[model samples]
Target chain A: MTELALAIENLSFAYGAKKALDDVSFDVRPGECTILLGPNGAGKSTLFSLITHLYDSRQGRIALCGFDIKKQSLKALARLGVVFQQTTLDPDLSVTQNLRYHAALHGIGRKAADNRIQEELERLNMFERRGEKVRQLNGGHRRRVEIARALLHRPSLLLLDEPTVGLDVPSRQAIVEHVHALVKEQNLAVLWATHLIDEIAADDSLVVLHRGQIKAKGKLDYVLQTTGANDAGEVFNKLTEGHKG
Target chain B: MRLLHYWRAMMGIVGRELLRFLHQRERFISALVRPLVWLFVFAAGFRAALGVAISPPYETYILYEVYITPGLIGMILLFNGMQSSLSMVYDREMGSMRMLMVCPLPRWFLLGSKLIAGTAVGVLQSYAFLGIAWAYDIQAPLMGYVWILPALVLVGMMLGALGLLLSSLIRQLENFAGVMNFVIFPLFFMSTALYPLWKIKESSEILHTLAHYNPFSQAVELIRFALYEQFNLDALIFTALSFFVFMSAAIFGYNPSKGMMVRKGGGAP
Candidate 1:
């Protein structure tokens, strides 16, 4: 079995007396593409925030590669890379410059950072547009650039919070495809948060989060087979609906 | 590599901010013009009305334009400080601000980088304003030019850190403009930026003493005296204390633990 990439236990979060994430617990294994699927306002975003150190959790613990999140956040964050829901890029900066700054923040080498940037941009087929300002790039291209930027540090655990929020179908599929390959190729652990079910593959692992609780979490096929449905989408709807009920 | 990484990150922030400033050419133009207007129009009308007198730094008759140059420099720093805070609020609204806090570097270093970047922008703007003062034939002490550089850098850092502190503590951009008018303008007006303490003393001893104790006044006088190749110990001490206060606030604002300054009014995230 691959080592546990992330372990969150008995975690609870409150937003001014309103419990956003209550009694939440889950584990994502290495080389796994575990999708945290739920509808809007179902605590998916809140959970992502807690994982990324956006806000401290009220109770329980968060561990990244066995390192306590609070005790060793730098070490935890060093191994972790996140792409936020909205575009976090500075629109005024060139694409290359944006990546360069991100690389700098992670303390990457000048020569190495330049080379990796070129390599990742080429991987996404965005090399020609490197020097263009971020405003000049289309939405799809910018999403691709963001994905490439997330991978720049070679993070072991990657988190994307509604990464395809504003993208078209093709762009969304491309991001999913790219992420799937990276997870397998690098044996990286990934927590992909989204409200869309089409993005989750049949064999991929799935965790259905509804109103701050994990109703069901297992292999996608196992979760679907238990529903006795033809496609994972139909089963996903049933699971989420039952979760709310 | 780490140091180089910091330099690159810092320069990149500066580059991005400069590019954004370029896009808003009207803003740069207007901000630059306000002080020039004060220098040429207001000072010209007030110069003769105020009459020339023997001031400590003044070797002979001095123009109002020359008297207000250092104060105007202080104004540039003041406004630039608020503008940086404005950008921080703007970025927070746009969600890009969190990207900055999430960097893998020590959070303080990342904040320090932003402070330096903003300070560089403020210093450059201050220097441009000073160039116009030079065109008015205002005589600054020759050695004062050298001293002014470090002085501006210090003032810029102090003001920038205050802005950082505000950005961290502020809940929304809506309240920032009010803070600018209430806090920043008062700090500028009540200071020695516009008129000397002796001039202010004629009106009220309370006002003169307040001006003397004002942190911003110290900043102004420090720059003012530096312009005349003089350094007051009181000004230096006050400036250092102000720096320590704002720098500590910024540190508290950015602390990953045991800090309430940054978390006071923000959303859960």
Candidate 2:
């Protein structure tokens, strides 16, 4: 009976007359990584926007650790960290400077922010690159900096929207392993949106979204069993069959 | 504790802005060069063409450069404001603005801090222009420099807020160039920045009325009076009121459900 790290109920969103997310409901629990599997046109990004309060919808309720996103946004958002699909770092600023700015936004003191910055950067093997401007970092190093920045405040829930989309195999593998370790060791809840089936771990929870609707939702094995799919890719194709994503 | 958090957030935003300003040496140079061109070249040419009647802020007959000094300061604020907003639109397009918007703070406070940060940079540019003008011998009363700080900050915030409002309305970065041509030019040319209201009135009644009421005109007069160690209540009130309206509209325009974000498909995802 632990409180859910993130809870969404009956969430719906539309752009003009076209629906983006239709009556979606889900929950993410602490210490688990929920892989939100969807294609390009699916409502994965829309759902992420709602949970992060980047967009508001009258059709649903979203709560973070028991606090409503709209009514108690400061409290709700304080418990959340995000690495958006786009690189949000100030390229002109050094890695440490970017992290410090984020930590200040969360109200972490200077000294404590520095300590956390070092710890997270070191965990991501980016401590040595702290003094370098973000523009100087390669794509992989920048992604690692972003991951480290997202964790500086130590939020219970981390929302990563396709964080590994353009990264190379090695960089992608490194980030995937690091995030899985975070879920296990820090009990951090993660709602990661991606179309890549390879990113789905065996123990991960799965939500298959296609054309703004949830087609399947459960543990990876359970979803594979229910869909009668041999693997994650087959599960995705089975759920989103005949639809142009 | 909450106050400390707010303070830290403000410092972070402002520090980042200053750092960015320092890194862009070209931006600093351009900000100064535009006003200096008007001072050294345009004012010298216009000094003979335009004769000043004793104005409230001018105790005696003054050279054209001295008369236009405050107007040029207004120029610096105006351009800096637009440039900052231009960067805002760019930031939105590039997704850095999304990072800022998602901060765990009240939306108004966050926007206000951005306005303050842009204003801080604008004020610095203004003072740098003033220092260069001092070297050029277009000096104001010593205390006028001190008095102008508050005036510059107020006017800078007002213009910066207008830029913020425009940034929210401008969905694409490409459309911003047109806005600059339309908004910045009309605001600059129609105001008292280049010519006196009376001089404008002599040419066209409608143009005169427009210049008389332009918020940029009031802003110029505000800085003009402060530079002479005087105060203009009318300009102060007008500029302050304009700031409130523009800032409120900007805050509304950034609202998730009600504003441009929802219309633009939740803005920069």
RMSD of 1: 2.7
Residue A192, candidate 2: C-alpha displacement in angstroms: 0.5
Runs in model 1 deviating more than 4 A are A225-245, B1-8, B11-27, B51-61, B256-269
Per-residue lDDT of B146 in model 1: 81
Q: Model 1, range A1-245, lDDT digits (tens) per residue?
A: 65678999999876666777888888988899999888787888778767777666668898988878777777787778888888888887889888887887777866888999999999999999999989988888988888888889888888988899878999999999998998888898999998777889766888888777887788987776777767766765776784432
In model 2, the runs with Cα more than 4 Å from the true position are: A242-245
The sequence of per-residue lDDT tens digits that candidate 2 reaches over residues B1-269 is: 99999999999999889999999999999999999999999999999998888878888988989888899999999999999999999888777888887778988999999999999999999999999999999998999999999999999999999999999999888999999999999999999988889889999999999998899999999999999899999999999999999999999998887888788775642
* Per-residue lDDT of model 2, residues A2-77, tens digit only: 8999998988889888999999998999999999999998988888788877788779899999999989888998
TM-scores of all predicted structures = 0.92, 0.99
Best by TM-score: 2
| True lDDT of residue B217, candidate 2 | 98
> Which tens-of-lDDT digit does each residue in B169-255 have in candidate 1?
776789897888877877888887778788889999998888888888998888887778877778878888898888788767656
True contacts reproduced, candidate 2 = 0.67
